[model samples]
Target: MEKLKPKLFSVMESYNGQQFIKDVTAGIIVAIIALPLSIALAIASGVSPERGLYTAIIAGFLVSFFGGSRVQIGGPTAAFVVIVYGIIQTHGFDGLVIATIMAGIILIAMGFLRFGSLIKFIPYTITTGFTGGIAVGIVAGQIKEFLGLDMGAVPSGFIEKIKIYSESLHTIDLSALLIGAISLGILIFWPKITDKIPGSLIAIIVSVLLVKSLNLQIDTIGSVYGEISASLPSFHIPEADFKTILQLIQPAFTIAILAGIESLLSCVVSDGMIGGKHRSNMELIGQGIGNVFSGLFGGIPATGAIARTAANVKNGGRTPIAGIIHAITLLLILLVLMPLAALIPLSVLAAVLMMVAYNMSGWRQFVELLKTSPKSDIIVLVATFLLTVFFDLVIAIEVGVVLSSFLFMKRMSEVTEVNGWKYVEDLTDEDYINDIENIKYKKVPQNAMVYEISGPMFFAAAHKFIDITVEGKVKKNVLIIRMRSVPSMDVTALRSIQKIHKTCKKQGITLLFAHVQNQPMSVMKKAGFDQLIGLNNFLPHTDDALARAEQLKCS
Candidate 1:
């Protein structure tokens, strides 16, 4: 009875009487910021403006209520713009809805599997490359929208997307271009004046007023999509079949990857801000639920927004109440004030998203990395970037993982090598080591000593050992191999060692292991190397092996 009480108690605990006003204020402020961008991102994504709001209201609320991170804010964001737009254009919204639902199922399963920590395994280079690629694709997509050109149902492929734009360059509408450029300019520089109100929101109001008052000849949302439904979301289960299911898989994967990266990255950024930890698996579960509901409500996909989450933490939102309030504020706006949103200009929304692309890009960091990082890493960076730009996000990710893995193996192989030597601690005593009169090993004949090793012998340094054991390179005899350096062995290194041992045997020299570790001893013992070599040979030290060599030579 009491256990059920705590679960209920936690939900009530999230609401604070004192902080509610502050949360409302922050929510309203953020809503103002989210409005223009949401509508623009929707339109740019080949959906209507209402869908974006539906995502913000429904998905945003669910994530805040159930998510592990207190400060995370959820909404339709710029990150999903390219992928969603492509999916809708190709497979239609029904396919997208199926994909979103499938992705939600995958995410939910992943959460239960506790696979959240695995998201960290994705390399930083790959993220940077694909993110940069997405940004480029987004910018290219908007050239048609921003310039108000006739794209004739816009191509889904990247090269085709570009070709469509280039061919229609002569059809640019000057009124729309002026609106877009001016809105972009205001958004870019408005932070210098004041941030109490978002520049995009203010630009939207100003542009709408200008267009309405001056009777500008540019396009408007009402002109294109009639009027948006400023209402709360209702449940929607899209029709699914074999064809829809098959088509949905690719987009579903893209959504899952995007959701995973975006959420984890946001959690990481918030951790830095609050000096706190979040349960990744719990957060993933929450995101799964959020996205599931997001699709059910006819909303675009949503994830943790780092900037808004940071803003929440920075402003005194220590609980999930702020996120909940954000949703409520949008809901209130939808119910009572949605009709007012039509006054916001479409060009202003594009400007806001353009700013989003700019902020997310980190071009300076990209260029700096290219200049400083190794050629191999740079190759991955450039390939992912180009593929993301010229091909598809899914393809870029696939090839990037393969390339990164192969390069990582090659780098590890380059440094892995083995060498045999008569180790002396003191180099200054080289006179005694080199001098014919005092050299310790001078009396040692060839084919007497053996040194063996057993451990995690891997590709990180396996090649040099092969080069060193070439014909005519022998300097000593009966080399007692000290097998203590090894704990485990891979097939490649084992093959190299076996080849060396075979050569020594062919040359009529005895090579033996001394003080082998139990594990490697058992491994070699089982492999019959211990039997083929004659069991009386292995010695404890180089000195004993030298003595054995001397005795055998004389006898």
Candidate 2:
């Protein structure tokens, strides 16, 4: 009873006091912001507007209580629209439910396995690429309404979609385009004009009012979607087969990855604002549970909403109370105010989606990376971007990861190369090269050249050190390999050195090592490399090895 009493007290803490009122007000404002977005995203995902509300109400509340970050509002977001639409088009809503549920299970398992930290390994190029890609996809999906095309259904495949839109260009409805253009303009400029109110919602209201007062023959939710029921969600069980589950696995995995990335990114942002560290694994577990319940309740995909989360913080949200209130407010609106949304113009929704697409694109960062980043980074960025835009996001991510790794290995191999120069750096002239020789060694004598190698001597970079070992290149009879900089070695490099030694023996040349770092020394010693070279040939520093090399040259 004593333990339970304290827990009860903690729940009541956010409910009472002057802070409660502020929380309630902030939550209501956030709820208003979430209202149209939830429906817009749900519609974009090829589901009912009610599914978005259900997601905002159920998953939104549960995530608040169990999530790791403060002020993070969970609901259906623009990110999942493309995948959901594809899944629904291919497998129907039941398939979407199964995939969402399966994805939730995967998320929970990831949390229990403590894999939240692994999300950091997902390259930024891939994230940004797919994000911008999805944004474009969402905007593309909304084009029918944006341009008021008399199309029954939009195609899913990118090329086919473009072809359909291009062919349907003549069937444009001028009213829808005008409304959408005006709404998009308002969304873009409303913030600059005023920050006190939500621009998207305002645009929706104005667009709805304009059509209503002018009596324009514009299509609305009432005409197209009919009435939306506002109530609590009922649970549903999808009948799923192995083939369906298997087919869904790729998309399910995509959703899990996106959820993991977006949620944690939101957590990180909230942490920066509040100066707090969140329990990443716990948060993943919460997200999994939330998604599981959300799918069962006829909801679209849900994740942490960064905009609403930031709004919460800006509005004095400190704990989960604000998040809970946000959910509660959504519930009230769904129950009491949903039917009224029937007046909202589809064009306005499309305009909102366009603004969303525009906001999600980190164009400045993309341009900056192209300009300042290295060749490898730029390649990954551009490749990921093009693949995402032109092909499947799943393929883009998989290929992007593989490409990034290969590029990294190539760079490592380049960094491992050790070479010599003819003219030694006169310490006086070293200033001309800006003292790059400190991290590097300068030119030395032709015959007893001591090449120093540093960095990871793995197979990738290890092959480059052998340029000095090639036939007819060495001017020295006794060459010393100073491995003071090498931190490790692999079997490939070890075997390559053996082949180098055989070639050296053929040409009657000797090789030695000075201050061979402990790690590489142990590896070479274990590999019996020292036995082949003669144990006495290995010295502790450059001076001793150089003396022996000079002595051999003299002889």
Candidate 3:
């Protein structure tokens, strides 16, 4: 019950009129910034502009009200542009709504299962690769609008779309191009003038007025997608069958994972900015609920938008009230200003998204990784990037995770080793080794041998232990296998141990065990390895094992 508590509740304990004033100012500013972005992202995602506003109004409010982060702002983000567009192309609008709802259910399950902490296990290289890839995709998707190319419906395939754009290069509208260039320039330089207002909003306004007042023959949202809807979204469930549900499961899972990753990343960044801690599980739950409502309200998938969250933080917003206000601001605009939005040039929206692509691309980080990261890391990064751009995100992520896991295992295997204790001279603990050597000279009986196993004995490194202990040149009347440095073992290692015991018995050698850790001991006990090797043969230390060997030799 305590875990279900929202951060909003805690902030309200110290909340006051001063904080309310700050939050209101910040919320209104962020809402202005979010307006153009929401519409642009939705247009890029192959949906009507108002759906974006609906998501911002619904998902944004719900997430902030129930979220674990103090300053997170939830809405549709650039990361989902490619996936959402692809889903819409293949499955239609109803499919997308169903997929989003399914993704919401999955997110809720992830939170309840406490899988939030596991997000860190996703490698940085993979995230960077896919992010840059999505940037490329966004930029590619916007080219048709940005250039005002005379083409009917761009193909979803990356290469095919590029070819079509090239073919339509001769049909570019000069007026549209001029407006787009100006919009992009304003977006880039507007911050230099002032940060109080957003460049994107200004760009939309200027472009709309310029095209309309001048009577320029250019495509606007109304010209391309018909009139904009001002009414609030009605509640509805997408029609889905068993087969449709099964078909959507893969994509829904992808959405759930991406949403979880992006939202949590936003929360972590905001926490750092404000020196606060966020409840990861609660954040996931909030995102889940938000997405569910967003889907039901005919909105696209939504998550915590990092840029908007940062905006909220920079403007002195420290409570969920700011986020709630942002949603209300958008709602007010939807009701009052939506008609004006229809006249805004589509090229201007494209310019705004192109800017979004450049910001989120992290191209600088990509180049730095290529230059400085290890060969394996570079391979994963480059492979994931290429796969994401040339293919789809689903395949890229799947292959990237597997490739990283295998590379990790290979590196770990190289560090594990099995060798004779005589090599202990190489250890930095010379004093301990000298003491053991002196004791061995007096206490160790003749024809006794000791071997040490170091590091984890998993499948990849299990053979090293077998080769050193069972197939090595060392022969003795009694052998002591020391496992003090070994932390854990798997079934493969246990089988190898069994083989060594059999070989020692066949060769007329007495085998003893020493200093086994709790995990390995438990496995050995469960496998009956302890009884097979004999209880008397197991000792707490190498010295005790040596004493037991001497006793066995005498007996």
RMSD of each: 5.4, 5.3, 2.8
Residues 303-357, model 3: lDDT tens digits: 9999999999999999999999999999999999998888989999999999999
lDDT of 2 at 334: 87
Tens-digit lDDT track of model 2 for 1-555: 011111112445656667777777778888888888888998888888888999988888877877766667889888888888888999899989998988898988988888888989988877777777777787788899999998678977777788899999999999999999999989988999976688989999899889988887878988988977877789898888888899999988988888888989998999899887677887787788789999998887788988888888878776677888999989888888889988999999988987887787777778888889888888888887777667767788888899999988887877775754342533456553775335344434446656667777888875577676533354566666777778888888888778778877887778888777887888898999999899998988765776676678755
Q: Give the runs in model 3 whose Cα sits over 4 Å from its true position.
A: 423-445, 470-475, 553-555
lDDT of 1 by residue, 1-555 (tens): 112111112546566677767666676666666767678888888998888888887877887777777567888878898889888887889777778878877877887787888899787788899888888877777777688886587776778977888899999988888888888888888989987778887788778888888888777787777776876778889989897798788889789878878987998898888787666777777788888888888988888887677767766766667787888888887788777766665666767777888888878879988999999999999999999888888999899889998898788666443545443433355565667333343344553443334335665546655544523354444555655566765566666667878887786666666555666556667777678766776565545655677676633
lDDT of model 1, residue 405: 88
State, as a TM-score between 0 and 1, how close model 1 is to the true structure.
0.84
Return the TM-score for each candidate structure: 0.84, 0.84, 0.94
Please, what's the RMSD in Å of model 1?
5.4
Better of 2 and 3 by lDDT: 3
Global lDDT of each candidate? 0.74, 0.80, 0.90
- Can you give the lDDT of residue 104 in candidate 3? 91
Ranking by lDDT: 3, 2, 1
- What overall lDDT, based on C-alpha atoms, would model 3 receive against the true structure? 0.90
